[model samples]
Target: MKHFYKAMIGLDLTEMDDILIKKTIVYLDFLGIEKCYFVHVAKDLAVPDEILRNHPELLAPGDESIEALIKNKLREFDFPASMDIEVSAEEGSHPLDTFLRWAKIKDVDLIIMGRKEELAGTGSLAKGVATKAPCSVLLLQEKRPPGLPKKIMIPSDFSDHTDLIYDFGERISKEMGAELVPVHLYEVPQGYSKTGKTFEEFSEIMKKNAQDDFNRFIQKFNHNGLTCRFILNDGEGQGKALLEEAKLIEADMILLGSRGRTKSAAILLGSVAEKVVLANNILPMLIFKKKGETMGFFEALFKV
Candidate 1:
C-alpha cells in the first residue's frame, strides 16, 4: 500500500468546484503524495480587438492568473508538511494534448482530473487521457464523498489484466481501510440454444464458470487485514451491470484496467470501460494500463 509520490491533477475551469479540489487533497493525503501539480487549460476565449482597447477591466489583473486562483482554493485544505504543491494554467487548442505533455514533462506517477460530459470542442478529454496517458489516470465526476472513498468497485473478466486490477483495488482498500468489491458479470450470447441446451441451462453453466474463475482469482491474494468480497452478477452489458452493482452496493470509487479492449472489439461490442466512464459520471474512476501493455502509436492517435 505504498503511496504515489509525484502526481499531476488536471482541472476543468468550467466545472471548477471546491469539492473537486477537496477530493484531490484527500487523495493526496491518502496516498501521501510528496509533490503535487495542479494544471488547467483555458479553452478558446476569443474577444474582439476593439473590446480590449475600450474595456480594460474585462481582463484579469497581472497577478490574477487561473493557476493562482486554483492554488488559492487548494489552500482551504490541509496538506502535510512533507508535501509540496505547484500550479499551471495554459491556453491551447487541444487540452488533452496539453495535459499529456505536461504530465510527461513532469514524469508524474498519477494524473487526476474531473470528467467532462460533453464540450463543444473537446469530446471527453478524460476518456482520451485515460486511454493514452503513460501513467495511471483518475477521472472523477461531481458529487463524490467529501473524504477518501470507503468502498471501491473493481470489474473483472478473468483476463491477465484482472489480477492487476485486483491488486490495485486491494492496495487502495488496505491503505484507506476501505472495502474492496470485485464484480464479475456474465451472460450467454444469443443463439446459444442451437447447442441443444436450454437458455437457462446455458446461463447456469456460464455463471458456474464465472464463479469458479472468481474463486481462483481471489485465492491468489492474501486478504490479511483487508475486507475483500466477490460479486457475481447475471446479465450482458458490463457497463450497465457495473453501474447497477455500484449503486446497489453504494460504492464510492471504481478501479479499472485500461487497454481492456481492442479497438475493433470496442467498436463491435462496445467497451466496458468507456461505457462505464461515460455512464457513471458521479463516481470516481481510476484507469490503469498495466506496465508492459502499452498502447501503440496508431491506437493512441485514433482509438478514442
Candidate 2:
C-alpha cells in the first residue's frame, strides 16, 4: 500500500513549544511526506485599532506573523529543503472550521495535530477535526517515536468494517516493520445471573466468544508479510482496557477507524476512540475513515 504523501498539520498557537515543533518535523521526515502544510487559525485575528496601533507586529502583513514564526522555527530544525512545506494562517470564527476547510483546499492526505489534554474531550476542537476531516488524522500527544513503530495496536469491536481496519493496520505494520496486535474488549451481559451462571463463569464464556471471533477475523485476512496476533480483554471500559493492553505490550502507536460522521450524528470519532484520546494516553493514534467514504455535515458545509 502506498503511504500518506500529502500532509496537513493543525497548530494551536497558544500551545506551541519546542517539543511539538520538533515532533512535527520528525513525523514528516519519518513518513517521507512529500508535501506538508502547517496551518493555524486565529479566532480573534482582528485586533482593536488602539491595540494594533500600539503593536503593529500583531497583524504583520497578512496577519500571519504566527505562521511566519513557526516557519522560522521549523527552518532552525534544518530538515532537507527538498520537502515541500508551506505555512498558512487564517482568521475564522472557529478553529475546527478553518482546519477542515484548509485540508480540503489543499487536498491533504493526512492531518496531524498535537493532542491537547484540555481539548481531548468529546466536544473539543480536536474531536471535531478528527471526526470531520476528509483524510487520516494522526494525534500526537508526546514526542515522536524514536524510529518506525515496533508494535501497532488496533482495538477492534469485530464490527463490519474490521476488514478495512485490518488491511490498513497490516499495511502500516509492514511499512514500519512492526507487529500488529488486534484486541477485542468484551464485557459480560448485565443480567448474566439470569443465565444460571456466575459472573466469573459468564465473563469467561464471553471472553472465549470474543477470542473466537478475533481469531477468525485474523485468519480471514492475508497478512503474509506481517506478524499479527489477537488479544482479548474482558472488561467494562473498552478504551481503558485497550490503553492498559497497549502499555503492557509497550506498543508504540495505536491505529483505529472512525465510523464516519454519516454513520451516526451523536458518536463522533466513535466512543472508544474518543475515550482513548481523551484519557490522555501517551501513544500516538491514527484514526481514519473507510476509503471512498462520503463527506459529513461539517465537510459538506465547509467545502473549499
Candidate 3:
C-alpha cells in the first residue's frame, strides 16, 4: 500500500462526527497515513471586508474558535495510531475558495470529505474537486454500511485508460482480502427498443456481449483470480441504471477509472462512476487515473 503520511481532510460543520469520516481516517491509519491535516471551512460567516479589518465583529485578534472546533471533532475520532493532527480553518468570503486554497498549500496526497445530499449543492462540489484537485481525492459519506469486505465492484468499458483501474482495484482488493467485480452495462441501440422481445431473449444477447468484453478486459491480469460476478442491465441513461444495479448486487464499494470517449473524459464522464460519486447516496466511489505508459508495482518496487 502507498503510504499517505501527510493527509488533509476538507470538512463542513454538517459533516462533523460522520461515521464515514471516522472510518476513512481509520482506514488510512491502517494503511499508514500518519500525520493528518484536518481542515474545516465555516459555512455561514458573512462578514464584509470593512467589518473584518476595521470592526472585526465575528473574530478577535487571532481568535481561533473555529480552529478549535476541528480539534475537538478530531479528538472524537478513534484513530488507530498516534499521528500528528493539525487543525486549521481557512477564512474567505466564499466557502469553495477558502477550502481549495488550503488544499493547494498543504499539497497532501489524499483528501477526505463527507458527501452531502444530492440536491444540496454537493454534486457541484464533487464536480469541482474531482477535476481541479492537486492530488487524488476520496469522497466519504455519513453512515455507510460496512458491506462485503471480500467482494469489490468495478464498472469498465475496456478502453486503453479504463484498463488501469483493473490493476489499481486488484491491488486494493488484495490488501483487504477481497475479490474484484467488473460490471458492464448492456444498453442496446435505439432501433432495438421496438423489437419487444422477451427479457429472457434480450438477456441472452446482452450477456453474450458483456461476457466477451469482460474476458478481454481481464486478459492482462494473469495473476488476478478468475471468479467474478457478472451483471447485465439495459437503460436509457448510463448513470441512473448503474446505481440501480449496484444496489441489487450489494456491492461493498464502487471503483471506477476516469476514462471515457465523450467530452471532458478526464474530468467529466457522466458515466456510472461519475454519477455514483455525484449521487453520493448509496455508495462511496474510489476513483483512479489511468494515463501514461506506466510501470506496474512489481516493476516499480523490485526493479527500482
Which segments of candidate 3 are over 4 A away from where they belong? 18-21, 42-63, 78-81, 116-127, 145-148, 193-206, 221-224, 227-230, 260-270, 290-304
lDDT of 3 by residue, 1-304 (tens): 7645566776654543355457665467444677678775655543335535644434633226556544656666755446777877666666565565676566566666666553244445545665444445666555565333556677777665665677777778888887777767765455554688766676777778777766776675452465445555554456666677777777767776665453234433435666656554557666664322211321232243
* Residue 5, candidate 3: C-alpha displacement in angstroms: 3.5
TM-score for each predicted model, relative to the true structure: 0.78, 0.82, 0.74
Q: Where does candidate 3 have its weakest 10-residue lDDT segment?
A: 290-299
lDDT of 2 by residue, 213-298 (tens): 76666576653443334444455466777888889888888988876435433224678777777664477888866534634544
Give each model's whole-structure lDDT: 0.66, 0.69, 0.59
**Would you list the rank order by TM-score, best first?**
2, 1, 3
Q: Please give the RMSD to the true structure for each candidate, in Å.
A: 5.2, 4.2, 7.2
- How many pairs of residues in model 1 come into backbone collision? 0
Q: Summarize candidate 1's per-residue lDDT along 218-270 as a digit string, tens digits.
A: 56654334333444445545677788889989998888876445532221112
Clashes of each: 0, 0, 0
Better structure of 2 and 3 per TM-score: 2
Error of 1 at 65 (Å): 2.4
